[model samples]
Target chain A: MSTLKIEDYDRLRSKLPNRTGGWVPGTAVYCRGYDMMDDLVGRVDFFQSLVLNITGQLPEERFAKWLHAAHICVSWPDPRIWCNQIGAYAAMARATVNAASSFGNLAADSVMYGQGTLPIGTRLIQRLHTQHLNEKKSVEEIVDQEIERKGGKVNIMGFARPLASGDERVVAMRRTAKNLAYQDGAHMQLALAIEELLYNRYSETMNFTGYLCAFMSDLGYSAEQVHRIFALIVVNGVTASFSEEAEKPVDSFLPLRCEDIEYTGPAKRALPDMTDE
Target chain B: MVNRSVKSRKEPFVKKASTNIWQEQPVEHNPYLVEKTHLRGYDFDELTQHCDFTEMFYLLFLGELPNRNQKQLLQLLLVTFISPSPRHPASRSAMSLGGGKTFPQHILPASLGIAGGEYLGGRQVQLCMQLIQDNHQIIPALWLEEQEARLAEADKALLAEGRIIYGFGQQYGEIDPYASLLADKFLGKSFSGPHLTWCAGLVEELKPYCIGWLQTGIVAAVLCDLGFPPHAGAGLFQLIQAPGLLAHGLEAYPKSRTEFPFVRDEDYDIVDT
Candidate 1:
């Protein structure tokens, strides 16, 4: 016998939807729990409303401004960046804008450049901070324990840029945060302490990602929340990359050659005898 | 501590009532702290230690962890649809992204986002699932008049909705053998499911119309057998295929970025405006 009763199932037919507190459907208008169309139609800027939607609360005006800093810093349109390259390829291939943005944003999850490491690092750092306060552990002791916990991979999260020796974006971001009076939170201090310790040991410097995570940690955003927030912040970079490609002629940006591609895999082989030869 | 579940959920749909697939601890601001996943009622903490990734994948979509057999079957399903040929539109999207020597991050969103078409990415299998759910008694048993009538209704409804049948045919009337083989092998092992059995019966019915069951049919059958709701089907396919998409995207990353794919395919005809 079938588990579903046709009568009951028919009465209950509907699409499963993820719930959200940020936006509520209010007939013809949408509500952000504040005001309806009047508040959003032209009153608020896109970035500010976005942050408000993300955290379920509005951030300080300056912090909303600081959110754009990462975009400005990381918005490299060079086809080498994964997100940009996808956009360029779509433009080159005469694919749609939808293809460029979807693929470009998806690329942000790659472990090296995007959302991959930040959340993991944020979680560990948050946990250690909790441990430090609750158990009264020193920074040095906490770093040592964290290093051991991560199996001795000493370069901790919210610190170090593998590509650039001195990440100038850090100075700019810090200044912006300071200007906004959102400075010297415990998470930021801990990040700096960790940065200092790592510098003493491995000479690695903290980059903009590290700073961004530190701010989120200080604001009580959990690792999972950081993942959502980070996606929001870096999407500007994704789009900036996308726009650069879409504007150019198809394949006009860094062209590729088929002949240069070396095949290291097994050469052409015959199919098994299961097929009638 | 034994992780206790607080809620139980089987249906992923909500027609007239409020339905949620994820639930958490009563405490605000500490969802994962004492979280309660709706389907299995597993404490969030316990899931981390006890659940393998394949089990986790099931839990995320179907809202409950799979048993050993279910897990193994799902693992195979995953291995099968994980990627498509590079010639596929989705793969073509990823390859195009890589042509610019871009980061690996950008390929998936483009490839998977708009992957909906006649083949593995289509809504055809989903429509078929709808058909089976609606007319289970008639479809599998060769109830010709009723099945045709029901299919005609569906065809009209689908036409009104501006959609086409996709799962059964990748294109107008073609099905890939590799996909068929994978589905066949999976069906061989996990035979207890009613949905799969019913789908087999439906295949016989479709033969007169010259319709062959495609990979999407196999996927729909397996998913239905596993008790997954209809909405989870397409998202699950994409999740399984993400890695394959990522791999192709990365492969194109280091190659020369100046190459024009469509441009090289055929030179554009210059005409006066």
Candidate 2:
């Protein structure tokens, strides 16, 4: 009789449909010498376990190593970086390390320049590549159309970072990828071609986002997974920055004089008519 | 023949609408290095130095600084309602996250996310605010009867689906003391807005149904008095409660790695249901 029919009960369930067997709790705990201990603790390393937990399969050793390198490349412990600054601010305010870590992690998850960019770039790369390969469109056509769509401000997600001639991180990540002998797949090749076209027209260099896009795509991770993993991987660096900054006096990390602020607003006006609405 | 997909978009109608309430500072550079907060372009330094937090809070919500009465009233409301008890689930989450040293970034957003659920810190206020707004100019006594009647028709439909009505009653059988204390204080205040009075009038009417006005109702009424949209209450409540979450998180900092109590297999008796 209701809009939600009896048959819809199974459809509304949050549980994974394919996994019909053992219970994988939201936060699984493993105790030494306890049942189901060896399955999580003794058999798999942390990264391997993380992959297994997220993707339902442990990646090969080479892929795990590559992932480790990719994690390290973004883990700059500079409190000056956007996401890390929250942690630093928390620390300086004499906030808890957990508070600092959690808030900093949140910064990566929400703000566009942090973990938000990874999924965005991944989606863009996949879309553009699909348009190029399957849709049989020229790179120029797609790039031009995208620029027009985004009001000509360059919608190419993985290139042309602000306030830099070029990122050194991309070079370092590529070097690490080479060291791991990680072959560039069709996605990466497509990204490189797009990058070349962008550079020729707009002087847009392939920033770390481009490399990250390629790396995540090569690992066969979906955009959402890439986003989550990006946050998980880079949070340690943000935590490090928070710990570093929290050592100083409250609000002392980058000491600011009151006069440094440019007051562009009106002078203080007195509030009128108290004791009545 | 080639089939090409054309680009599709919803007709351009405010592409990005975060609203006048809050916006990220447009500066692309190191935002913390210089001032980034634009509270209606209020000088952040001066605002902190001269104006009380209520004035700033008013600007945050209304996009304009408040008058003296508005400021003082808002301050009282904040004092009355913005209590983040340790027992609150959001605070509990913050404590757990902090205890585990999860990292600085996850604490506020994560805790606030916990706060923004169907029950607890969010939905009661949201529902109260909406009901109050929808029945804005109604005679409160009569309106209360109408509400009770309307729900009476739908009550069986709700109970069948395990849905308890929000904006009234307490988890415990009795009325919440916090709600009563704030109500006393609210009654004592000289500036009694119609919304506040309207919500107060509904309490007696609702009592026979094992429901009494909770903190969520009064807070919603006060916010409606202050001219915020009903929808903004939950998010604003979360924001106000953030410092309390931070405090809990900070308290948890020195503790050892303690995951929030997970259900152990042994703890549950798996007798046939």
Candidate 3:
């Protein structure tokens, strides 16, 4: 068998249906592992399925077991989890700004900055900086001052006291800030901006799972071995409503978009037949 | 600050239309996402003990474990943003019904309604919700066909002549980088199988329509997996994007940008000369 090259992988990847754009607007593209398996295992194991489709070789049982076990075991107690989530949200927010900044007719700069900064700023100030405020002053007064300091216009609509207290006010302020972040007539533009932000942030982290699968391949496993590992992980790692149905083992690995399987050691005989252009 | 009243503008023809086009169509619940709540050996409070509220949001909404902080935040933010407003226009509209509204039932539909339009504050959230719903039933191919037909008709009529399509295209005029970025973030993380499959199915079906516009469709599908209602997805969008708009509006406000009264410019012809 011919060894698979990155170029071959890329060529095949290009053939798969690209559906990344259809995600709901404003959703950060962060799929929980359990969720993905629960959704796709019947058709295929996400990692192995992706690998098999990409590399045309099914993984061996032992390799599948090891990979699945490793994924589940390593998945525990990740410290970066929280940071990744907040970072994704921040990234999505930034994407929104990027989308609007590209518009020609609008006052793109001011609109982007004002709308982009205030909601996040309010969140940061409330979550991080509120503790430093004058103790004597009420939370509402602090928020009002902050709004003034930031040169933001405050039109207290219904609840005034809620706006005065920092904690309570942050809630109302953030909501109001979100509402005011757009120009009066730019709904479609703003929607696109938010959607773009969500898409960018989501895509950035989605490849990591594929990367993890590749890591297993680099550890001296063949394509079939990798597929089984993914299947094992899907079978064991995930919790579902219908465990009995989901627990059933599959005959073949389901193909995924990113599959990187490599043989161990140097001078690995590349599969000439498999290397079809 | 310019004195602008926060009161709802009562337009002459703004009566609520009774014909609910979406409601008329009976939506079959995707069995993957929704199910009868059975007592899985684990106690609810005990499960709560091991997880944070944010993680719980992941469990409840997307029906899986929380993979990253941003996912948790997105869920929290949605709940935070979409929580029924006690004094919103809809809430005020509801007051005519009687006393204070209850939980899920009262707020759910009302929130869904609020998320549906342009003038209303929750358009992005509504769009997000609808996109989620759409991803489940309509694969990408069909969706694109529908979108193309709409865009074609709109384009032919010169309706969207200069304007960007509502969910298509971007300001950079390039493929949206964010869509792929987020999808990468979410690819391996676990989620509801049916929902994710439904999303994948959407990606497959919509592939043809999104050849050049692939990023938009992918991002829409990912959001759907995140459990946003297809219709209200846009409203959630507005919440996430509130910052950009706020920045622009505030900056422009200082320069009296908001002061420009709406005027009919006859020179602004629909068909460019």
Provide a comma-separated list of chain B TM-scores, one per candidate. Answer: 0.71, 0.79, 0.38
- Name the candidate that leads on TM-score: 2
Where does candidate 1 stray beyond 4 Å? A1-28, A246-249, A267-277, B1-273
Better of 1 and 2 by TM-score: 2
Best by lDDT: 2
Interface RMSD list for the candidates: 30.0, 13.5, 30.2
What lDDT tens digits, residue by residue, belong to model 2 across residues A68-175? 777787778988677788878888887777777766876776434667688888988888878888999897898788889889887567776654545677777777
lDDT, residue A207, candidate 2? 71
Across residues B1-273, which tens digit of lDDT does each residue of candidate 3 receive?
A: 111123222436422333111111112563223221211222344444565665554544444445664464355344433323343444333332223222222333333344334322344334433555644466655665666766556532122111223333331223335544544444455443344455445444533333122233333444555655565355444444333333332333334323433223322222211
* TM-scores for the candidates: 0.50, 0.58, 0.25
lDDT value, residue A183 of candidate 2: 84
Kindly give the number of clashing pairs for every candidate.
21, 18, 137
Candidate 2 chain A: worst-modelled 10 consecutive residues by lDDT: A12-21
lDDT of each: 0.62, 0.68, 0.34
Write down the lDDT that model 2 would get.
Answer: 0.68
TM-score of chain A of 1: 0.81
In candidate 3, position B202 carries an lDDT of 46
| lDDT measured at residue B179 in model 3 versus the true structure, 0 to 100 | 43
